[model samples]
Target: MKNEVKHVLGLSGGKDSSALALYMSQEHPDLDIEYFFTDTGEELEEVYEYLSMLEGFLGKPIRNLDPDRDFRFWLTQYNNFLPSAQTRWCTKNLKLKPFEKWIKDEYTSQGYTVYSYVAIRSDEDFREGLSSKNKSLVTKLPFKEVGVDRQGVFEILENSGLGLPKYYDWRSRSGCTFCFFQRKIEWVGLMERHPDAFEKAKSLEKSALEHGSPFSWSEGETLDELSRPERVEQIKRDHEKRLAAVARKRVVNPLRPDEGMVDLDEIYGQQKICLACHK
Candidate 1:
C-alpha cells in the first residue's frame, strides 16, 4: 500500500452537495479534490443544466460516473419491479454500485486511503447506513465537523452565485425524476413541469404493476390513478391545507428569519432519502 490519500466528493445537483463543492474549493484550495456525479440517466434536464453552470464556477468538469447497465436493464433484472423504499434496487445499481466500482478499481487497488466527502449537514443527524465498512474507504463529514447547518448550506450557495437548481422552484429533493422517495405533491409538480418525464414514470409504473410488482412510484395509488383530474385537485387541496397548517404553527426564529419559508420536506415530512443519490 502506498503512503498516500485521495480526496473525492460527489455532487447530487442539490443545494447541499453543490454548496459543499463550493465550500471545499474556497476553504481548502490546496486540496486537489476530485468531484463526480453518478448519472442515473433518468434525472431531470434541470439537473444537467445546473451541473453545467456549477462546472463554470468550479473551473473543473465534474466527472460523470455512468452505470454499466441502464435503469431498464435493472428493472428487467428485478423482474420489472419498480424500486421502492422497501426494495431500492435502483439506488443499489444506479448510484452506489458505480461509485464503489470506481473506488475499488482506481483508488483502493492503487493502495490509496480514499476519503469520501459527504454533504451531511450539521443540523441533520448522522443517518444510519452512511458508514463504510471498508477499511481503506473513509467517510468524512466536513459540514458536520464545521457546524454548517441547513442555513449555512444556503448561505454558501447564495454567496457562490449558484443559488439553487431550477427544480427547486417546484420540486424539492434531487435525484431521478421519478424517484419513489418523492412526495405526492412533487409528483404533481413533475406532471405539470415535465409531462414527458411524468408520462415515462407512469408507463414504467404500469409495466411494473402488470408484472405483479407490488410497488407503485407513489404510495397507495398508481400514477394512472394519481394523475386523474379529480385526484390531482384533491392532492392540491390537501397540500394547501397542510401548508396553511404549517404556516399557522411556524414560530419565527429571529436568528434564522428564513425559517418561515415553506420547506417541502416539512410539509410531507422528511423521508428516508438515498444518501448516494440525494447528497
Candidate 2:
C-alpha cells in the first residue's frame, strides 16, 4: 500500500533557520510543511520570543519537541561532566533524540514518508548530521537547492520584517544560553547581559571541575576566572581588534553595502557549529 508523505521543517530559533522558514512559507506555500522546534530547556529568552514572532508569520504553531529528561538529568547521566564540543551529549539527548523519537513514532510507525527540511546555506559545506537513519525519513535542503547564501538569508528576513534576533548584537550564534561553543568575548557578553544565566553556567562548570571533568564551559579557564575584571577587559579588547579588522576588509559596494554590512561569522571564524542548534 502507498503511504502518505509529510513535509516538515525544524526551526532552531537562529537567523538562518528562521530565514529558511520564512523562505519556505513564501516560496512553497502550496506545500503544507509542519514547522517544529526542539527545545533544550536552557535556551535564551530571546529564542522563545523570536519563535513567537515566527509563529505569527507562519500562521501556524511551531511544535515544541522537548526531551523526556532535561539538561540536569542528562548531566547526571554523564557523571556530572558538562557537555562540551567534544562530547555533545546535550545535543543528542536534548535536541536530536527528542526530534528522532517524535518523528519515528509519528511517521515511521505509521508507514509514512517524512521530508525534513534543513537550512544549510549555499556558501557553507554540507556536514553529516542532517542524515536520517530511518529510510522513510528523507532530508531536504531548500536553501542550498536554491543557492541562497548568507546575504540572501538576510534579505529574506529584512523583506519579511522579521530582522535578526535581538541577541545577535551580542551573541554570534544561538543554542543553549551556556553553549560551550561560545568564544571568550561571548562569555563576557553573557556576564554583562544575563548575569543570572552566567552565574548558573559558572556553577555548572564548578561542579564539572569538582567531578574531575576535562572540559570547562570554555577552554583553558573557568567562567569564574574568565569573568574577572582584567580578563573581561582583555577579551573585549581582543574582540574589538577583530571587529576593526573586519571593518577594514569591508568594501563599500555602492549599491547595498550599508544594508548587507557584515555578519558574525565573518568577524569571528566559523567554528564547527551544530546545524540543528546554530542554523
Candidate 3:
C-alpha cells in the first residue's frame, strides 16, 4: 500500500465530499493529498463559486479535470439523448473517464499507485463508485473507516466555516444544472432560483424529444409540463407534506437544532445518486 502512492480526492461540490476533503485535511494532514474536481461544463454557477471558497480552506488548488469533449458534444454523440439514472453517459464520458485518463496518463503510467479517497459515509451501505480497471489505482473511504455518518458530515462542514454550498437550501444533491436525479420539487426550485439554467434544461429536453429520445430530464413529464404554475404549486405542496412527515419521524437531538432541514432524498426516496457528481 506504500509503493510511491499518489493520494487524491475528487470533490463533488456537495456536502459529503467537501466535508470529506476537510476531514482528511484536518485528520490526515501528513498525507499530502491532491484534490480534484471534474468539470462537466454543465455545472451550476453556484458549484463553481463553492469550489473557489473550498480552495481557500484546502490551501491548494483543486485540479480541474476538463473533459476533452464537452456535454453538448457528448449529447450529440448519443443522438441528443439526455443522460438519465438508467443511462448515465454523462458520468461515464464527463466525470469518470476524465479522472481515469488524468490519473493513468499522468501518474499511473509512471508507476505511481493512485489512492483515490472517496466520500462514502458510514450510515450508507456500500455503493460502487468510480472503479478502476488498473490494479494500481485504489479507493479509500475515510468517512466509513472512522464511522462518520450524515450528522458527522454536517458537523465537519459547519466547523470548517466553509459550510454547505448555497444550493443546499433548496437542493441537496449537486451536479449538472439539469441533473435528472432531482426531485420534482428541486426542478421547481431550479426554476425559481436559476431560471436561466431551468430554461436551458427545458431546451435540452426539447432537443432530445425532437431527436426521438424516449426520456425527459425528470421522469414521465417534460420540463415544460413540470414548470407550469399549477404543477409547480402541486410539487411544492407535495414536498412540504413529505418534509413535515420526515420531520415528525426524525428524533432530533437537542444539542443541534440547526441541522433539521428536510433532505429531498427523504421526500422522494433515495435514488441511486451520482457518486462522481453528487457524492
| 2 versus 3: better TM-score goes to | 2
TM for candidate 1 is 0.97
TM-score of 3: 0.96
Which segments of model 1 are wrong by more than 4 Å?
none
Worst 10 residues of 2 by lDDT: 255-264
True-structure lDDT of candidate 3: 0.89
Q: Give the candidate order by descending TM-score.
A: 2, 1, 3
Report the lDDT of model 1 for residue 275: 79
Q: Give a tens-digit lDDT track for model 3, residues 1-279.
A: 235889999998898999999998999899999999999998888899999999999999999999999999999999999998889999999999999999988888888998999999998875767567988899888888999988889889989999889999899888999999888888998999999999999999999999999899998899999999999989888888888889899877888777676677776776778899998
Give lDDT tens digits, candidate 2, residues 189-261.
8899999999999999999999999999998999999999999999889888889899888787787665546
Residue ranges of candidate 2 with Cα displaced over 4 Å: none
| CA shift of 232, model 1, Å | 0.6
Error of 3 at 80 (Å): 1.0
